[model samples]
Target: MRRPAAFLNLIFSRRSIRRFRPGKIDAEVLKIILEAAQSAPYYYQAFCFILLEKPEIKREINESCGGDFIEKAGASIVVCLDLNRISGLLDRLGIVHVLKADTYPVESVLGVFESGLAVMNLIMAAEVMGYGTLILDCALYECERISEILKLPHGVIPLVIVCIGEKDENPPPRPRWPLESLFHVDGYRMLSDEESERFLENMDKAYSVEGYLKKYAGWAGSYREYLANRALLTREVRRAYESISAFLRRSGFRP
Candidate 1:
């Protein structure tokens, strides 16, 4: 399929940028980008964004977020949803159906997907305007604290935080798995032991444990420990999941 010129430009040039030049994205441009984000499709619910603009606030957020790069970001956006607005929007937009009297699927599997579509639009808009952007799932800092700072009411779960700015470096394209390895024609087909070796052959060695250890220590090791130690994944994970549940319940999204 032939993509329109601007669409192709968005797809090719959109890269997650951590490093950013110290500057500001203009107000008009930021508004346009937000409009683009809101225009994204909803599979089951509607989500809104909270745009973080003030430098002092961004600095505070940077401390909580654990990344120095965030302090220089031109802007940050927190994607969230008002449960009823989402529920109503989903029904109105045909994103959700009244499957039964007291049951709704929007609260479960579909919310993330809705957010994904909206964020893509956000990225596309930022990229087209010559701004580099990074989707910060881990750099959002404290969700509840941010809610308090932003003055967001109960029920808004900030799923993804995006930081945007002028880019500094041109990182080389990382290798991708071969077409055959990634694209399966149909069905779940199990690979033979020999076939698995062949699959790994075409894959870049940088993805391997030894290769990763050369650049950064303890990545694969930590993962290995995660496999061995149940505590590694549980300590930080349960609270977040519980928080999501709490937000959902408070916002009228069950589960």
Candidate 2:
């Protein structure tokens, strides 16, 4: 096998950093990161970034989104699925039929897909530039409140918040499922109950060694318990889902 490129190492070494040293990112460096995002391959170009640098704005977002680390980062960037720009262009070109009610679902999916590609590029660029970064999806939990705080207009929905800054702590990489379970050959491979249990055991042992349960969920004894405690069928999770759905509908991404 050919050796991996040096840049690929950056992807392997990247970790989600929560603690950051106090310092603002240089304007030139931030501009380069944004340029990298623009370089991502896209089918519809339906994405935009809202950069939050002010302490007050960051504090507001942190409160609304429930990511306490957001306020401490050098900058927090909201990566949004923005179909508004496309809708405007279509309007100018007299192509209104493309964005009719039936197409909203398809547009929403495509917008999120394209935005994810851009987000990966933005993150890798920042990592290669020696900045610690954290990706927070908590923004989705309170999307309506966040939209109000960010003053997002129609046809634009915040997907994730990327926080970048200097690293204050160095931690080992988090545990992940085995590659055999994740990667399949030509066709999908179904795992047996035994295989599933083995994978879970391995993950639980690894997380226990790292003290992940104590740090994140002290009440949970194992990683499996931690996951069970955060089950999605609960009332709070349902409310978050409802809020996200309402935001998507109001932003014209849902029918």
Candidate 3:
């Protein structure tokens, strides 16, 4: 058994590595990591992991996602929610032609959540195996194209691509909001004006404290401005949403 302290150490030490050394992970180790990921809790195991190892596939994914990091990683796993699997199970149970238009969205949400848990488990497993990991939703921008390239089936919708490789950089942890500001006892309570002001002040202090913000100089910006600019809420993001909606319709998962 791992020492309690060591387990906690591993959790705290893991980071999202953007760069990686050119090396391949052993097949056995990769298998173990995947096994750990599959161990994640789920409602109905309605998800699948697509392991991408081919250089040509990785290159195409990188090109489509507008990044080289995915290609550089030793391996990438695309987490997909298998709506078809769920429907197949329903069919096997003799629930023929049940119109689940309203409930399908909830099922999709639960499937995505379960998939997220599995991906996180895999990330931790990779880190424990002494490999760096990075998760990206950039692939969602070209989800339809990537799915076609990967030859994904009708009901499997790709959520995120996780890259695994040897670490090439060490970086400090990003700032997080204080627990007091975020958590409320028993039932949730909205913060008052004064409390909100204090929270913001604490957040700024945390950002500048230990020179963390300085390390990310020019990379930092105001969230207010970011929201105002609506830069990330691009047509591509909207189209991606529309594509997913269409996929659901095509998969017969809609009302």
Candidate 4:
């Protein structure tokens, strides 16, 4: 096999950066990044990128979503699933019968999926240009507040906030499920009990080496325990779920 290209190496080296050095992204560079995002494949092109450089707006987003790192970044882009734009275009073209209520659910899913692909392109372009990126889903926890802050119209939902800036931290790459556990050839494979235990053991070892449990959840003895106690469906998580669900329905993304 041919050696992996530099772009593949860049993808492998990319990390979710939270701490960023103070600096402003040049307008031309940001334009290039956004153009790369627009090149992503799409089903309906139902997405919009709202670039936020104002400190006050970033601070408001931080307050709403509890992502203080957002204010510290050079800039943030809110990737919105904007079905409203598609609907407007359809109306302008007199395509009245296209977007019915039954199609809303499929369109919503496609919009979100396309938004993710565009976001990946944006992130990779930034990374290749020597900027760190952080994808924050915390916006989902306060979707209504984010909508208000961004002045989004109905059918426009903030799907993610991407923070871009120079890096200030160099944390180790986080662990993931083993390839055998995640990948399957031709069909899905159910993990055996022993395989599950091995995966957990590997994760525990990696997290232990990184002192992740000690720093984040001192009470938890292992990665498994930490996930169960702190990362699973806790009260705060349930509240976030409710908030996102309600906002999706109100924004016309759900039936």
Across residues 183-246, which tens digit of lDDT does each residue of candidate 3 receive? 9889988778887666656656666554544453343554333334545767877886787677
Q: Can you write out model 1's per-residue Cα lDDT over 100-164, one digit (the tens) per residue?
A: 22445445447667778888888888888889888876423366666666776644666678888
Candidates 3 and 4 compared by TM-score, better number = 4
Misplaced by over 4 Å in model 4 are 102-104, 213-221, 230-240
Per-residue lDDT over 1-255 for candidate 2, one digit per residue giving the tens place of the 0 to 100 score:
876878877888888887899888898999999999989999789999999877788888888766477878887899988888988887887665566564447777877888989988988989889999988986666677788888889988888999999989877778887888889989999988988888778888888777777875565577667777777488877886777787788778864
Residue 247 of model 1 has an lDDT of: 53
lDDT for position 208 in model 1:
56
Cα distance off (Å), candidate 1, residue 45: 5.8
Cα-based lDDT for every prediction: 0.65, 0.82, 0.77, 0.85
Top candidate (lDDT): 4
Question: What is the Cα-based lDDT of residue 145 in candidate 1?
Answer: 64
Model 4 lDDT tens row, 78-126: 9999889888887888656445464347888888899999999999999
Error of 3 at 8 (Å): 1.3
Strongest candidate by TM-score: 2
Model 2 residue 236 lDDT score: 79
Candidate 2: what lDDT? 0.82
What TM-score fits each model? 0.71, 0.93, 0.82, 0.91
Clashing residue pairs, candidate 3? none
